[model samples]
Target: MPLPDLVRRWQPGWGRCRTLPAATEVPGGLRVVLGLPGRHAEIFALDDQAVPALAERVAEAAEPTWLTVPTTRPGEVHIALENADLEPFPDAERLMTIELDDHPAHPVPNAYWAKTSEFRGVHRIDLTGHDGTVAASGLAAIVGTDAVMHDIRTDPAHRRRGLASAVMSALAVTATQLGATTALLVATTEGEHLYTRLGWEPVATMLTATAPMSALVRT
Candidate 1:
């Protein structure tokens, strides 16, 4: 699919995956009212050309907001955001996707137990340690034929144990069982290493900017 059309399909599922309000389409892209501390809302620009306008919009707002643009050249997007008085966050994330059929099986490590559950339309998996502590976890939400994955993470104390991979596998199984054929997620640079190993391909780099911390403090 074209990147633009892929983004259009991806955004709403992302919001649903996070249980956030539906995204609203505006002049440049889609906006979601996040309303969290240090984050009042966020706008996902359709492309680089939309970044400047979205940056300017956030710059004039009293509430802290984030602007995320998907592009290969984050340096240019960073410069445009700086020009608009927005602070660009370092280490751009990757927008990744995979055909569920291509995802390989990763069994839960012998030391951990995997549990999958669903609530409010979101499917969740938890990898609990042998001692019963939660070691890693992730969630997926099915939207039509696609499944959006969110917040797949392992505890700092549990690195290098294949727990993260187990969490991902469990979530994928749940999503596929629920009739989803594709999977998508925004992954950190560190995460890209793991997803790529699991057959997910990068579609674009995601550059994010927010109001400067100093400015947010006064709001």
Candidate 2:
């Protein structure tokens, strides 16, 4: 299926833009908007649309704090910042979703977490080895019926011993118990097959962009 059509299959609360047509705006805004479900914002050509008029509007908005255009033409005054925290887009990543009850119970392995913590809506589990050093970790947040996992990482030396799986399993167990029925995660190229093996199905191709770093300084 076409990328846009596949994107449409995302449930309204999940991937609303999965099936977005090439030219449709996401509801309201000056042809741009934020929080249209999933991560990132949706906007038109950054250079042509936001140079003077829309740039002023971006400065005025209280949240999201940047302008995002999925594509750019030549000579656009946008910066694709190369930094650790830069958003992912254009190249493509996997947006995977899975049903909670579709798999076996995801109980945390007894030796998995040397420490665990939760504050407000976020949950964290630290996977430690015998020496009590943190080997891997995972995080998840539950909002309504959705539990999305982020930043699940493991140290190189600890990679294939199922530590990553253990962290996710623990997170899944906790998230499900907290009334979450839907799970969402974005996987990198290296991790995509691993997630698929764990039963997550890729449903869309995502492109993420954000306001240039200069925008923040100018504010």
Candidate 3:
């Protein structure tokens, strides 16, 4: 299987499992997301299962707009949206390393991220220039079943100096050593270019819509 397909198959099963408002099902080798109340629904297929009732329920709840299915492959895996405007999904076009069971004994080396509480359980690699001040950093998490690469950043003064590449390479090497087969991230346009140059490939485009907390709360 391609790396993207492997990663997609692993997601939802191995990564975060939450009882989201939306429910999921598999019918006829398709993965489907049902009962999403907004202008949209999500669908994908990973295996074979019958779920006509679930599809009927979703169709009943859908708005008048045509269903939008964003997929990496037609009829393979897709996200369906109802009453939602079609927009480009935010994605990065390069490949990063995915580490499955890597636990680094050494501590993370970046100080800026160290101050934040969310930095825990994340391993990092720092890139230094000839002067030795940290120029860039790559951070990644390798849990038992899931791996994630987050926050690849370079200092403002160090832009265009290749520090990002250096740190990302360091992170990838470490992730490979740790046994991760796939790395995942949401990338910006510029970052996507860099990642592709470094051997990352785009797998799927993602689209998202947000509702404010105030809207969710009854006025």
Candidate 4:
């Protein structure tokens, strides 16, 4: 599928996974009202070509908003800041997808164990330390044939312990059992390397930026 199509597919699942309000379609893309501190809402470009107009629209809005484009386009990023106070965030996110497969059994280390849970269509997996602390955790939500992955994290102290892999394997098994054929997620720079090694392919570069309060003021 095309990059834009994958983004469209990923949005609803992401919203569900995060328990945010449903995203509404806008002239050039989709919009979600986040209502969080320093982040009021977010607009996602439907395609690379829609970014210039979308950025201009974000500049005219009156709230702390984020403008995002799926694929890297330097010219568009420049245009986004040309007439507004938009500050481009680092290019540290990659949208990735993987075909679900039979998750082979993987044993947890002697000092750790795993747990799985589900609630409201979201599946969660956690690798817990021997003392009952979470070492690594991740969430997945199945939307249609796609499962959206979110919040895959391993504690700093748990680094290099393969706990992340264990969590991912558990989530994959859960998603496959839930009838999902593919999985999607926005992976950080560090996560991209891990997911890549696990066979997830990059769909596009995820770019995002937010404007300062002064920039949102309209004359």
Candidate 5:
């Protein structure tokens, strides 16, 4: 399937853009967005209809600091960025997804904090097993006016179980309770079909492109 138009419209700002202290300029029909990566710089070009050609030019001019493409332009080529890598578009099947408007008031299941953990906020459910073994977990974040669902993971051994769906539903309910009108997240191909089946639309295909210092320094 093609990339969702809504996902194509989503653009990152300076704080959210990841690459910073950069500049953007439009030369002709192409817009050149540049970001400084230490001693070198990376560039990206955004042109709705000319995405393919523009991407090529950007790739040639300077390495991309970070980039994303819609599934609509699957034929377009892209490179990865340093300090980050791109996430492939999920298949249009197998992802169970949903959005909620209120925050779940109940205590989140599987609530535990570790020093190096990336998990945050209150998870609605925790799928742990006997002997205190954690099987899976979910996370949510407040990004401006939107409620962002960060990471939702389940153990491979627990596949085919409803644990992931349960966690998602709980988080949606919690988000709604917290006054979030809509929730957003990116799912893997393995999870897309499930999400669509659960009424979560395919908003867009997010392409993660990165540029390393080696690429930039040479450019």
Candidate 6:
């Protein structure tokens, strides 16, 4: 229902995935991480009140950790840090959750639909044009009962032709076959508008963090 819970559903096959205080109670308190060997940490339902304590715990953990929460509450930074500038993402605060009923009906040439490859349960699809160039591409990763659609992109020359929608439709069909009932993704400003038209909703905002060099190098 809520966006954070929706995100937690998509994370699968991890060493640690549970609520901070307890599983029975939830509002803003879930920690989905592999710890130690994990590249980063994702914690949801973590209200600002919990961030300080959470940061302390992280400081004492097996190693330095970069905690990313849906809210701007900062466990990795001193104060709340939202990438309004969209440093790496280029479109800030536009996280969306999507679900399609069966498949969307926007006809594309059958030749357009091609499954390029699949690895580690993630499926990749490409829409190639008559010239055999990759016009659009998307990926779906089925983890547990949740499916995450990611990295949907269309070539600049292929924009406005609905190739992204075609890719999404194909991925949605594949998701159902994999038994995933829900799908989620983080969208950019441009993507948010396109996805909304294709039936996705802006459910929540996302904030991500990574360990700084100092932290990473700390003994």
Judged by lDDT, which candidate is best?
1
lDDT (Cα) of model 2 = 0.55
Per-residue CA lDDT of model 4 for 1-219, tens digit only, reads: 877799998998888878889998888789998887666788987876776677777778787778877885656655555445567775537889888873344567778888888888988898899778999999998999999999998999998988888888888888888899899998888899999888888878777766655333210
Candidate 6 stretches greater than 4 Å from native:
2-4, 13-48, 54-66, 72-79, 82-91, 109-113, 209-219
TM-score-best of 3 and 4? 4
Residue 109, model 6: Cα distance from true site in angstroms: 4.7
| Cα lDDT of model 5 by residue, 132-179, tens digit | 666666665534444556456788876666666766666666556566
Rank list by lDDT: 1, 4, 6, 2, 3, 5
| Candidate 2 weakest ten by summed lDDT | 10-19
lDDT of 6: 0.58
Alpha-carbon local distance difference test for all models: 0.84, 0.55, 0.45, 0.80, 0.44, 0.58
Clashing pairs in 1: none
Task: Score candidate 1 by TM-score against the native.
Answer: 0.92
Give stretches of model 1 more than 4 Å off. Answer: 213-219
- TM-scores, each model vs. reference: 0.92, 0.58, 0.49, 0.90, 0.54, 0.65
Candidate 1 per-residue C-alpha lDDT over 68-162 given as tens digits, one digit per residue, 9 for 90 to 100: 88887777878988888888776788999999999888999888888878888888899898788899999888888898898898999999989
Question: What's the CA RMSD of model 2 in angstroms?
Answer: 9.3
Cα misplacement distance, residue 143 of candidate 4 (Å): 0.4
- The candidate that achieves the highest TM-score relative to the unseen native structure: 1
Instruction: Compose the digit string of candidate 3's lDDT tens values, residues 36-143.
Output: 344344443232121233334334543411122223542332232212223222331332333323322333344322221224456767666556676777676655
Off by over 4 Å in 2: 1-91, 104-114, 210-219
Candidate 4 displacement at residue 128 in angstroms: 0.8
Question: If both were scored by lDDT, which would come out higher, candidate 2 or candidate 3?
Answer: 2
| CA shift of 19, model 4, Å | 0.8
Better of 1 and 3 by TM-score: 1
